[model samples]
Target: MDPNSSKRHLINQLSPEDLKARLANESFKRTTVSFYKYVILDKPEEMRDQLFLIWNKLHCYGRIYVAKEGINAQMSVPDHFWNEFKEQLYAIPEFNNVPFKIAVEDDGQSFLKLQIKVRQQIVADGLKPEEYDVTNVGQHLNAQQWNNAMDDGAIVVDMRNHYESEIGRFANALLPDAETFKEELPEVVEKLKGKEDEKILLYCTGGVRCEKTSAYLKHHGFSDVNQLLGGIIDYNRQVETEALENKFIGKNFVFDNRLGERISDDVISHCHQCGSACDTHTNCANKRCNVLFIQCDSCRAKYNACCGDDCQTYVLAPADEKESLEQRLVFKRGKRFYKTDKSA
Candidate 1:
């Protein structure tokens, strides 16, 4: 590591309040957007290093992962800095605006610090590039366009992972069962094969994965494939600006601290146990195992912010004893067959 570089530690994440205050003081307004491209990169290490240096200087902040498979990013860039950011990115032929998708809700501190890292696969679904045509991709559509097509009986599919889709999705969107990105790609194509000539609309968190995924489907002879132009983020912005009719209902799931952005103001997701209309996705409070699950505000308060009674007990104990208990209950995600604690 370079001697001039800042120290790095997993536990040393920046505080959200601190970041928000700094950006506000700077009068920095940022545009939240993202995009992806699946192409074989000859020098991932060199690319990662260069990207980190460039983005950091621009005061850009967001999560970005690059692999030999492709590059995926979800970031917030200062509004005044957008021109230079786009110029520097397009300077690399592999990425040109690449038709990026802007986030719907803008939080000054969407990400803490600039982090560019190399990985095996950008989205972490272990599938080889040879399995599908990552280069060709699918058609792009906006919220208005996607909604109209659905009115015509088109088959709309949510291209995001299970956790993302569970919180906010198009009312009638076909959600894939796969927990990862790679598995869902081929599965969605196969499921829509019968409707090769029919209008097949696809969407995702920020519209990055669907870009290449759509191209892959077209390469396989899917006659008609359309994607949400800016994903759910851009769709939300359009709804607010144009006073357009809202087609997508419920909270639009986000990966950042804000958790979710409510589009239609309807509580679609329920508290895992109480069956109340709540749309919050939370991490399990079990100290030993950090499994992710959902719970409403009421349930969250009653359970003392834990997922279940067992988690409540574990959390209530002293730190050392809790650690000991965690070591004991440390088995395979043992609660897979269990239901969300409703008794709280």
Candidate 2:
């Protein structure tokens, strides 16, 4: 790696306090927030540069993306500076009050730096622009309301990937056994082809996927489709507002160091090995196939963080020798062996 890239990568790994202080005595305490807007952007690179300059000044830290289709953002800025963040977001014609979802748990270390990248799709669905009408989305519902709709025989489908749904979902939500975001979207739609007018509830980690997904369903003739307003994040938020019981159970898996956040007293997902109902998600400790995934405490120890015995040796291998061993393993088995489930 180039020295500059390596150094930048190292900086992004700093601790929360160190990162806060290292940003050079900024004037506010950061409140972490996240949201995505899936609208067409004319100039992705220009959009990326423009947001970077504006956000870097606010000491914002998290990830954001811009594409020909739209934008997705997960960021932290000073609590006092939230207005500034909001203003900057709304200044762009497309992002006005665009419903961003908050994470269920607040970790001081959720993000270390601000990053903006330009991509082809905000969330890669591998579909052409004309595949589905992206404008007409489903009905929106708050936590309490969504739960009520579920009671009325709504086909509550977990709108996240299988692993994500495995950890947390609405009670009895039909999980699509899907391994990817794009696949699950169509799968969920196909599964409910004839049930267009029935109450349909959809949800995901931060609710952005459903923005386009709900639109797709609406285009496909699904009438009474609805989604959790802010997804799990907003669900947790309203859980406090109405003092409603947490209808969703277990831990909400996240894409950061803090892993999963608590939503209720119930524990749903079990340790893949020991079967203890823990919601913590961890990557396989094996360096070669370090799949970003979920595992519980007991399983963490049992696998020594590797997820399986094949990975165990790789995790224990000396750093200098690890590369050659990885090459050899790959040369012998190809990518199929790497795809084997190591989800403990």
Candidate 3:
């Protein structure tokens, strides 16, 4: 073996601050794009290493998950390298012809660094292998068809977790009070117990969760299960292009650094701190208590961008007493301080 080959590291070693600085200093433009494909991979670890090298060479920055079942990725690529990135990625047999969903609202600073992780499953549905057949998914519907179904009284269900749907969803969609997909699956089943044969329309951020959810519904004897073809992302895109009636209201929650993108001007959700109308999701400034929550500009200033008074005190406390203060304060809302259990 060559001695120089030992120096090749497959992971990023830069700190977040350094990565952000590097991105800030760059002169070129970047485009935010996301794509996922559920194709079987014999050796995910090897594939991960290969992809890291490929993407790193292209100066791409984003998060990607690889598993035996498939791969899911969301990243920003330099505009100059976009064509090359597409060509090289499409050259891979497993991901050949995979559809790309470009961010409708992009600021180019979506990600600061590259992170490719190997997981047991890409989306973390928490199910045994025999629970449902992914290959046997529900019918895929475009924006027009989905709207028509809604017009005909088809049941609309948000397949995302509580925090995601808290900010936006279809006008009459059934929003589950689930914190995780594993919990949501059973909850949805119970909610639709009596209407197994009725039309079910499920949607998520980028259509990945709905892929599994639609199949799970079918496994539980749901006959007319359907999903948004590309989820809220594509639905919004089509709603703009085709000039269709937009049924979705508020911001569409995302997993990137931006957190979310606006789908409409309506601020349906309220600030978790003050109950003021706001849809902006932000994490507490207190590093130790980085709970995700919605905050308006006013509460943000009052709380110093922390979740609540306790978190704000903890953040402002001197470094010596910070630990003791954290120990003494029994946070009013527990670990996830701002999480809501209420559902529509």
How many steric overlaps are in each model, in order?
Answer: 8, 1, 0
For candidate 3, write residues 254-298 as lDDT tens digits. 999899999988889998877889999888887776778889999
- Residue-level lDDT of model 1, residues 152-171, one tens digit each, is 99888899877777777887
What's the TM for model 1? 0.82
Arranged by TM-score with the best first, the candidates are 3, 2, 1
Residue 69 in candidate 3 has what lDDT? 94
lDDT of 2 at 75: 82
lDDT of 2 by residue, 1-344 (tens): 66576335322456767875775555446666778877778888888878887887876788787898888888877777788889888988988878766666674566678778888888877766676776778877988888788777778878787677777777888889876787887788789877987877888878878777887787778887788888888889998888987788876766655667888777777665566666666666665566554456666777787556667766777989777767644221212222234432
Model 3 regions more than 4 Å off: 1-8, 331-334, 338-344
State each model's CA lDDT, in order: 0.74, 0.73, 0.88
Per-model TM-score on C-alpha atoms: 0.82, 0.84, 0.94
Top-TM-score structure, candidate number: 3
**Top-lDDT structure, candidate number:** 3
The regions of model 2 sitting more than 4 angstroms off are 1-29, 327-344
Stretches of candidate 1 off by over 4 Å are 1-31, 38-40, 78-84, 219-221, 330-344
Candidate 1 least-lDDT 10 residues: 331-340
Q: lDDT at 275 for candidate 2?
A: 63
